[model samples]
Structures are given as C-alpha cells and as structure tokens.
Target chain A: MAKIFIIDDDEQLLRMVSLMLERGGHSTRLISNPVEGLQAVKEDKPDLLVLDVMMPGMSGHDIARDIRANKGLENLPILILTARAQEIDRETALKSGANDYLSKPVTSQELIEKVDELLSQPNQKMMPDRGVIIGMFGLRGGVGQTTLAVNLASALRRISQQEVCLVDFSPSGGQVALHLRLQLRHSWLDLPPLADLDWLALKGNLTLHPSGLRLLAAPQVPQLATEPSPEMAAKVIDLLQKQSAFMVIDVPRLFGPAFMAMMERVDIALHVLTPDVISVQTAVQLNRLLEKSNLKFKQKSYILNQVQVDSQIPQATVEKGLNARVASKINFDPNQARALSQGVPLTLTSAKSPLATMMNRMAEVINNRVAKRSGD
Target chain B: MGATHFGRNQLIHMDMFTDAYRVTGRVLVGAGGIHAELANPSSSFLELKDAYISRIHQPGEIVTHYKVAAFSKDNINFIVLQDRREGIPVGTQHGRSIYTRGRALSVFLTVPSFEISGEIMHDGKVAPREILVQSVGRYQLVFSAKALASLYPQISYSGDLILVQKDRIGIFCLDG
Candidate 1:
C-alpha cells in the first residue's frame, strides 16, 4: 500500500478520508493542523498528499506552493480538497502546483480512485520562462537522426515564422549538409577561437538556407576529427540559442565532455532508433546512460524511426525492451532518399508527403511548447 | 523512468478512467450529472464502477481489475464520510448544528476484525450509558478514529471520521 498523507482542519473529514483510503488498502497519515501537516509532508515523504483548501492559517494553495518550492518535495503529487468547487478555486490550487483537485463532498470510492490515478502518473513540473534545445541522435548508425534534424528544422522554419537553425555537431563528419545540399564553404571549424567567437563571428560561419533556416555544418573531411572543447561547445550553443528562437542539433552519439556540456543546455534529447534488435538494445543502453549520468535535458527519451517497410521487430517489442513509450514515430518515406541526394529536405520539397506532414505537426507542437514555456 | 507514459494512446486510456472515476462513482453519462442507470435505493447491493481488488500484503499491486463490481451493504464492515450534512441518509441524525456547544471525550468500540478508538462530542450530558441509550442512529460518528487489528496491534489504520455500524459494536467503552 502507498503511504498517503492528508492535511485538513476538519477532524471529521480527515477520519472519513483516512478510512476510505485504508479500505482501498493504502496507509494514511492524518494531520488536523496545517503547520504540523506541512512538516509531516516534508519529513515523511509520502507517495502523495491530499490537502484542504481553507484552513485557519495556511490554505491548501499555500501548502502546495511551499511543497513545490522544497527541492526534495517539488514533484510530490498534491490533490486539493475544497468546500468551494468554484472554477477560480481550482485555478488557484493548480497555480500553486496542485496535480489534481476534488470538491468537499467526495465519495469513498472516488477518493480512492483519484489517489491511485495520481500515483500512477509521473510528475511533470515545468518551470516558466525557459528556452528549449532539441537534440537528435541515434546510438546506431543509419537510424535517421540526421534526416529528422534536417527535415524538422525546415518544417520548424516554415511554421515558426521565426529564426530556426540546424546544427551538425559531428566531429568526424555527418550527413546533415549532404541532406541539405549546403555549400561546404563554412562549418563550426570556420568559427573564430572560443573567446573571440561572438554571435556575429558564429553567424558568419553558418550557411544560410533558402527556407530562412541556418546551418552550422560539420567539417567536410573525416580525417579532420577535431572536436570542439567543452567550453567552446557550450559557448557556441549558448550563442545559437540567443540568436535563434528554435534550434535543432544533429548530435553525434559521443558522450564526451563536449557532448555533456551541450546536453546541459539541451531541453529535449530525441534519441532516434529503428525497429531492430541492435537498434533497440543500443537505445536501451543510451537511456540507461542518460538516466544514470548527470545529463541536464529535461526530457531524455527516444523517438521510433521506422526506416524499413518490414522491420525486424515490432513497435510493441521495442517498447517492451526499452520500458518507455516512443515520444514520436516516423514512418519510412520512399522518396526521402532522392530528396537527400538532391541536397533538399523532404519537408521543404514535399509538404504533401506523410513524413513531411508528421514533421510539420511535430514542429507545430514544439513551437507552441517553447512559446508557452518561454512565458510568451 | 517512472510509470510507462504513452503520448497519444495513454490519453485515451485516461479518458476511459474519466468515464469510470466520476465524483460520485456513479457513471454520470448525461449532462448535468445524471446517472447512466436508474437509482434503486431499495436494493441490498451497491454498484462500483472500475473496481480493482488487491491483497493487503501487496496493496499497490492489483490482483484483479473489474470494469464493474457490486457489493452487498449488509456484508460491509462500516462506511465513512467527511461530512454528515451532505445529506443524512434516511437513517437517524448524528451531528448537532455547528452553533451548539459540546464536550469531547474518547470512546472505544469493536466490530468484526478491528477495534476502533475515537472522540465523540456529547451535547447535553456526559453519562456514558445515557449517551449510548439516547443516541438514535444505527450509525454513530467517531471523529479522529483509529482502527487497530484485533489480532495484530502493529497493523492499524486511522481516519478523520467514521460513520461506524453501531449495531455491530461487540464492545463499547467511554472515558471519564
């Protein structure tokens, strides 16, 4: 049974709620005063908290805000209980960081069900006014992370109506520029030294795309495997974020110091994997590394990139192996190969294509998410 | 790394729960809170939507999940609620108005598998026998009550208020 803590001024209500949950086979702690209740929530660290809206000194909203502020308790699921079922009251509770709410007259079964539902969910606590960096990479070669990067950047450029940049961070060279057909005149190699590389200097090295998207292409030669220093990589990413409203990085699967520095600034990491045994195992290992390491992406997960019409393994099997849901799934497009050779993104050339439509929709979602999260 | 969360398909699953986990546990399919089935209070059994049964040892894990389940009221140990004023069932009244004055004292009662201790607010007299004889309800209020296992004291549960089955109380004690 889950350890549930309830904070309410009404002794009768507390007893009723406790008994109801206990029937559902959960152990509960009932506190009559708000002050003691808050202390117990912090010290005990229960699986969930049910708080009352109106108490003598501290309201439920205030307690929620305090719990959210506490570093260890920030993600604790809080259910607000209120005598007043007004819309405004709910709004207040949620703003103070309540996961869910129920009005005063609650049934025994309903209370049990809500508590279980909240327990089943993972807490998604997002801070306001933050920028986003979307990184795309696959542990196994030929899994289509570069393709996604190029096409997504093109689609985002069209949809966002704002500056969008696609960066190829492969030290040993990558297919990003090949897919975009950009001239190999400038790359991250052309940027000035780290201390001198301001946005203007970096801007001069970026190849401008016809779609108003910019490209920070990788070096043309595989022999010149010169990876940027961690500081240099962080500075470049920071500058890129300041200049562009949206940025997509075609990351190479190298968990070096540079990669770690860049990941610290990446808000989302989309680890692409094809439907195959080797690909799924590689993605699983990558997920384990991301979870164990102090990597700083808010969302470190994977996207299922279906490259073959007949995959070696099914999506269900892949999900079972990784123990996570695919953040997105992209089906293979027949014409994508021709588009890649022509140095044009599929999203730019074929808006009517299924792959292009998916990219466009994803771009729209990312755009809205960034805008809302950035507090626009 | 927590519970497996689906992007699109999981949302549809939650919508199914929204159907089952209504505020009243009654499937209010129609607008303005109307039950999908006609209410029959005269029946012996109560209906529960989306009932999940779990063992006491592994309460977090479900042994069986049901889309619907029925329970006979006569078999239930007791019922509890936050407020008695929501609507006193066709049974006897327990609470006096908030404006009335009362003295609080501890009471202990026992039912089938558990022994319960709670405070009762007596309005007029403090006589233990007179309080029990004068009470009119089959269900009595036990505020801040804790139920301990009759066999194992280590296993205990506490709740804010319990509308206990007064008729099932095998033993009752009142503190001076």
Candidate 2:
C-alpha cells in the first residue's frame, strides 16, 4: 500500500478523506495544519499528497508551490482538493504545481481514482550531480540495442528535464544519429586531439535535436572516422560529464580496447538481447567475461528487447542461460516500426501506448538503479 | 464481563464542536458507544487523544494540539460521528430495537456559529419540541447530518451522526 500524506484545515474533511483512502488499502498521514504538513512531507516522503485549498496560515496552493520548488520533492504527486469548484480556482491550483485538482465533497470513487492514477505515474527525479553514464551493447545487430539507447536517452531528457546525450560510439556507419533523424553534419570525427581540443571544439561535434537531446554521432563512412584512443575517449567523457546529466552510449558489436574502456566508464552497462538461443549464449559469455576478466566491470545486466513477436525462445530459458535476471523487458512494440521510420523514440511519443509506457518505465528503473548504486 | 465487553478499543476520528471552538482528534471508544461515554452523567469531561484545537471561525488552521485532552461536556454543542450507531447508546443499538418502527423525520437546528440539518428517528408523534423535551439524555442523536457554517455555507460537513446537546440548540425545526 502507498503511504499518502493529506493536509487540510477541515478536520471533518481530513478525516473523511483519510478514511476513504484507507479504505482503498492505503496508509495515510493526516495533518490539519499546512505548515506542519509541509514539514511532515519533507521529513517523511509519501507516494502521494492530498491537499486542501483554504487552510489558515498556509494555503494548499502555497504548499504545492513550495513542494515544487524543493529539490527532491519537485516530482512528488500532489492532488489539490478545494471547496472552490470554479474553473479559475482549478487553473490556479494546477498553476500552483498540483498534479491534479478536485473540488469539495469528492465521492469515494473519484478520490480513490485520482489517487490511484497519480500513484501509477512515474514521478521522475533529478539525476545525481556527478550524473550516470549508461552504455548499451549487443554482440550482434537487430537486437534493439540502438533502440534502447535512443529511447533511454529521450526518456531521461524528457522526464528529468536534464541534459542527456546519446553517443553513437560505433566506429563506423552507426544508426544512432539516423534513429533521432539528425543529419550526418558532424560526428566525433570533428574533434581534434585531446590537448588541442577545447570545450567549443568538442561541443561542435555533438548534434542537437529539437527535443533538446544531444548526440555524438558516428561518421557515416567508417574510412573517414578514426576511433579515438582510450586516453582521448576518457578526455571526451570527462568533458561530456561536465555538461550532460546522463550520457547513453550505443556501443558497437565488438569488444575492442576502446570499447572496453567505454564499458569501464559506464555507471550501468546494458546488454540488449532478443529472445533467441544465439542472443542468450552471447549474453552469457559477455556477462561472465565482464565479471571474470581484468575489465571486471559490474555490468552483468541484460535487457530483453523482444524484437520478435513470437517464434522466440522462452524468457525463462534466456535467463537460465545468462545466469542472471533480465533487468527489464522491452516488449515487442508494433509501434517500433513507425518510431524507427520517423526517427522518434517510442518514449518520445505523447500517446500512452503499451510500448511507450514500457520504455518510460524501463528508463525509470535504470535511472533508479544507478541512483541506488551511486548512494552505495 | 468488562474484559469481554469493554476491553477492545475503537480508534475513530471525530470532531467535537463547542460554542466557541472546534476540537478534533482520535478518540478511543469502548463497547459502550461514544454517545454513551459522553452522555454518562457520572463523567464530567470527555477524553480526546491527539487533540487539535481551532477557533470556530478559522476552522482550517490549528491553534494548538495536545497529546491528550479533556473537554467539559457542558461546553460542546455537538460531536460529529462517523458511525451512526456510535451516536446511539450501547444497550439500545441495532438488534435490540425498542421501537417497532420509528418514523424518520427531517430536522434542522442551530448551534452558536453553525446550522445543522439531519433526520431524527422517534416512535412518538412527529413533534419537534417533544424530541428534546421528552428526551431523558442531554445529547440528542441526529443521523446523516450536515453542519454548514452560518456565514459561509460553502464550508459544510456531512457526518453519519451529529450528537447534539439539547441545551446548546438556539433554534429547532422539524419538517412534518
């Protein structure tokens, strides 16, 4: 059950609302004073908040605005319940940063519905200051590796409103840039040597999308593109970390020194795999090597990108072979065909489709895991 | 026995309104209902746990809260109840009905700062004054009651039961 925080001046209403929510299998913290309520919200973070409008010293709108301004509480879902049912009142409450607004005398069903809906949503959080680097790789192509990288990058940017960069670390002919519909005007090839490179010179290499996502594209022609040495890669990363809150790299289909260095740099290493015998076997080998070798990076994670609708190996079989749990599944979204054609990530679409929801949730899961790891 | 009938505690949130202030909190009620406990002639004060006190006019803001509080029953105009049977005495509740078929009549009454409307169940003739004059207890039970602020009708409460003090009623009207 989700812990819900309720702040209202009317004790009768507070009692009613708490009882209603509790009936729906939710635990509640009822505070009649907005001042104490705000303090309680900060001290004990609840899944959702039900705030009343006309409190004495502090109004619900004022409390909601304060919560939005707070660093960590910005994403806390707030549902404002007020006696003022006017359109202007609702507009003002929403403007005050409440997620949803309901008028007074709310029925049990309506209150429960609003609470449940808000709880289901992913209240995205700001990534930590140092930021997280996520590298996506698959030993073979058509495994949705680039798709995961692109969607994760888009999700992180849209949800957190933070700087996210998708890097096409593929040595040649990478599709990361194409996936986001960016013209191949500039790639990592544009950058000079580590010492000669300044901030502007490196910045010029990134292709910025209209959605505010940046991309370090691979050169369209492999012959023209020179893979940066390990030291150069590290320098570029050092610069990118200063600007980007999250850097999602689409690693190539090889385990070269440069690639291994990229793997070592990532906070999370995701190996995208399809539900196939070959994919599972390759993931097992890669995961074991990542743990056993000198490169002993703790990224034995596998993301099941179900590219095939059916005629596939069972997920249980795949997990058994890999000897690790599938971190998350990117179910076979039929919309992928359109998302790919349009160069828009499935997560970028505004529609609440199954595939989009899955992608967004996967992004959130990956982000939370990184945050937890960082805390540790 | 006391252990079998009164040992268990029912923790409920209730609002008790006096002529001057509104006190709200969780109250622990035994087998004997809250009305029975409050109306008991022997006890002069009703105990409230986690009490919040607010002036009648500024109902939303809390002036103070106490770990424990006691209110003199003489000051309370009415107490809003979530359970209607809690408004009724322990022995006279549901299964052990004394009235064959009590007629439900709409009634309106006024306290200091608020006006309340609800239904009253009685076995006698539909007389507004008789319900109060003939009642042996000091507090009367009003079921499915709504208390509206006299100045701000928008600020209103609909409770399952409003245990009203007969002496505090400034005006009483029964709809026949």
Candidate 3:
C-alpha cells in the first residue's frame, strides 16, 4: 500500500478523499492548509500527492510547482483533484507539473483507478551517489543565462526523470525565482554563516519549483553584498550534489570567490553568449580567463543565444573570434516573454516551440555525459 | 525568398513590441513561404531580423528597412523599401527571413540508481556487498551482481543480476 498525501481546503472533500483512498488500501494524510501540506510532504516523503487546484493561500498549482522544485521530492507522483473542471484548467494543472489531473466529485472507483495507475507506474530510480554540476554563466546581461538555467533544469528533470537543483548565484537581483514565480519564504540569505551551515541548514534554505527543480535563490534584496565564500560555496555545492542527480547553477556576471568556487566544482561550464558584438567580446575574454585560471572542469562549451530579433554579429563571426564552435544555438520565440511574464517556463508553456526543443536537446546531451561519467 | 501575399481583407491583431518594432495581428509563417502584405506602416521603415538577415547585413548596415508602416495592438501595415521605390505592393518573404527571439539549449537523462554498500541477506546469512539497487518495471528491486563482485571479492555470485524480493533483503545503509 502506498502512502498518499492529500491537500485540499475543503474539509468535507478532504475527508471524503481520505475515505476513498483508505478504502483502496492506501494510507492517507490530509491537510487543509497548503503551506502545512508542503512542510508535511517534505518530511513525510509520501508515495503520491493528491492536490487540489484552488487553495486559499497557496493554490494547488503553486504547491505542485514548489514540490516539483524540491530535489528530494522531484519524482513524487501528483494527482490534481480540483472542482474547476474546464479543459484549460486540466491543461494548466498538468503544465504546472502534476502527473495526473482528475476533476472534483470523482467517483471512488475513478479516484482509485487513477491513484492505482499513478502508483503502478515505474518510480524514478534513486539518485546516484555522485551528482553532476552544470554551471550557466554569461558575462553580458540579457543573454538569457537565467532563462536557460531555469529551462535547462526543467528540461533535465523531464528528460532524466531525476532530481535537478538550480542554484541562483547572481550577486545582485537574480531572476531565477522571479522566472518561476516562486514566492520566497526562504533563500540562501536565511542560512547562517558558512562555518555554521550543515546539510539541514542548507536544505531548509531552498525554494522548490513545481517543475521538479529545486532553486537556491539569491537574496531578494542585496544586503552587505553577502555572498557565499569560496569554501562555503564549494561545501554547499558538494552537499547539493550529494542530494541531487544534477546541480544546474546560474552563475552571476561578477567574477568573485563564489563564482570561482562554483566553476571549480562544475562538471561543465556553459558560457552563454548572444549574436552581438558586446556579448561575443565578453565571451572571448571569459574564455581567456578560464584558460588562464588554475580552476578545472571536465568540459567547457559556448552556447549562442538569440535573445533579440536583430543580430549585431553573425554566428560565424562569433565562432571565428572566440576560436570555439558554438555548441548550441537557441532560436528566438515570442512566447518566451509571455511565459516569463506569466511565471511559467516556455518549456512547459510551449514544449513544441523550437526554443523548447533546443533546450530538450541540450538536456539530452548533459544526460548522456552524466551517464558516461557514471559508467566510468 | 519572395514576398507572399496574405488575404487582402484579413485584419490581424498584434500586441507584442520590441524597441525597434511592434508586432500587430497574428501572422503564422510556416516552413513554406506565403504571399502576404502589410496594409499600413506604423513607421517610415520596417526592419526585419532573422538568421538570413543577420548573416547578410554588414557590421553597421540596417536589415529589412521599409517605408510607411503603421502598428497597433490589432493590426500592422508596412511597405518594403523595394516596393516603395518601385510603387509596387510589398509581399511576404521566406519564413526563415523573419526575426524572432533566441533560446538556450538544455539536456536531461534517466534518473540513475542509488549505489548502496552494505549488508544484505545472502543465503540466509548476513554479508557485506556493494550493490546497485534500482526499481524496475513498477516496484521490483534488482541488484547488480557485477557491482557486488567488483566491490566485494570475498562474496561469489554466479549470475550477473539478482531480483530481490521484498522479504529477501536485510538492513543496509543507503549512503554506505
């Protein structure tokens, strides 16, 4: 029998669902408050999560996104049970990262069947002992580094069916949390000094995304310019690697101890650039710096992003100037702005778009590299 | 690619705008070229940005310049530079010539199995062996014998794999 956690604001419906699940020989835990339910799920690590779309404080959609964002609970099967039965609602529920969507007033048989189906599906394999670290960095702003980081994490979660943690290392205002529209109850700022941080302390500071990607967001406000020291950053990354299958870090433009620390641990550093003279120039400089630095990584690649419709430089020009082939090129899509504004990633908003397709392709490449590393 | 004409009477609404241009009306540019025209111009020139244009333009040259354009949330109309010079109607070019936003590449893979190095029930006796346990085809737990042999030479296992029935396992440390 699987342990199922159900979160709904309706007390009567909650009890009814508990009874139905219990009748199916499944142990059920009910929570009327979405926030409490989130905490309980983290601690309990249930087999399945039955979420309601419309909650008072936190909607089921947001809750699902949050649960998906946690590395520890990335693979938890979620069945969305809500009263809003519109086709669009169901679509939104699934897009928000719910495994299954079931309308409210579900018959006991229907509920049981759906739950059984979800439970019967193959559970994601546990994370390997070692994890792969991927760092996304761009010297120039608006090169789509944060967007790539968020979508890459989402794509990795989808392709690998594994836990992927996205750490926002931007010094100023990082947009990782903003892109996902995650409300920050906790952030890296909450952690005590690096000397005092442990697994528990570090884990508590992460904000979960519903895309099955955990985020370590930058401080909402820049205070004292407080950032992790190199040693502390390494320790945190090591800990995150232990907990997750892959850690995708969004490194800020600033070159500092923390950035160097991340670079040292990263398996691959994706130096993001756009088809612009300034972006290409910065990338060339960054490449030279990486070559000269003592820090080492398994692989270093350049990703050409088409952030703007107008290009000031051609890909060939960029390749020739940098002396490195562009490993990947992401096409420009108008829907990206909409997705960003709506706080949903384009990968989920328009999966078939060329942009999403390219992101998925990149995720596949990373997965293969990780598998190769594991085999070795 | 040549300019293709859209329906003459069709009025599409465009709502998104960039610093250089404003998009009005829904124009679906497919892989194949279509014939279309902008009924009006919001500005004096329409500059198109796309892979082809970016490749062809000189370092400082403006790409896809047009004259007499009008833009609104519901509609866009413009005249191409060539058409305005020749007093001919502007037409649609290849879809590839249109400027659009750029994206980033990502990769994903199947979740890997946990490697546990600990004691498991072997022949009803507790023994230490390093094994990789993965849930396959629902909830069946399978152990890798090769992993065990490589890590623990003392334990001899004949098969390359072992299916651990729920009751056949004993105490084990996941991280060990």
Per-model DockQ against the true two-chain complex: 0.01, 0.02, 0.01
What is the C-alpha lDDT profile of model 3 across B39-150, one tens digit per residue? 1233332222211110111111112322223333122111111111011222335422211111111111111111223122222212223222322111112222211222
User: What is the TM-score of each predicted model, taking all chains together?
Assistant: 0.47, 0.49, 0.45
lDDT of 1 by residue, A87-125 (tens): 444655766777778876789866876776566432344
Docking class of 2: incorrect
- Residue-level lDDT tens digits of model 3 in A1-376: 7899999877998999999999877899999989999999999899999998655566677888899789888668899996444344565676677777886558997798678656643233422348878889877988999999988888898888887899987665678988899988877767788778888998899988877788899876655666667887888899899899989999878887788888888777788998988888888787778768866655667778898877778877988888865666676777788889999887766888867877775676567445533543
Over all chains combined, what TM-score does candidate 3 have? 0.45
CAPRI-style grade of the A/B interface in model 1: incorrect
TM-score: model 1, chain A: 0.66
Question: Best candidate, TM-score-wise?
Answer: 2
Worst 10 residues of 1 chain A by lDDT: A122-131
Which structure among the candidates has the greatest lDDT?
2
lDDT of 2 by residue, A236-336 (tens): 77788888878988887776677777877876667789999888878777767655757754444677888877838876688788766565565677888
- Fraction of native Cα-Cα interface contacts (under 8 Å, chains A and B) also present in model 2: 0.00
lDDT, candidate 2, equals 0.76
User: Chain B alone, TM-score of each model?
Assistant: 0.58, 0.86, 0.17
TM-score of chain B of 2: 0.86
Where is the poorest 10-residue window by lDDT in model 2 chain A?
Answer: A120-129
Ranking by TM-score: 2, 1, 3
How much lDDT does each candidate structure score? 0.68, 0.76, 0.62
Off by over 4 Å in 3: A1-129, A222-224, A369-376, B1-176
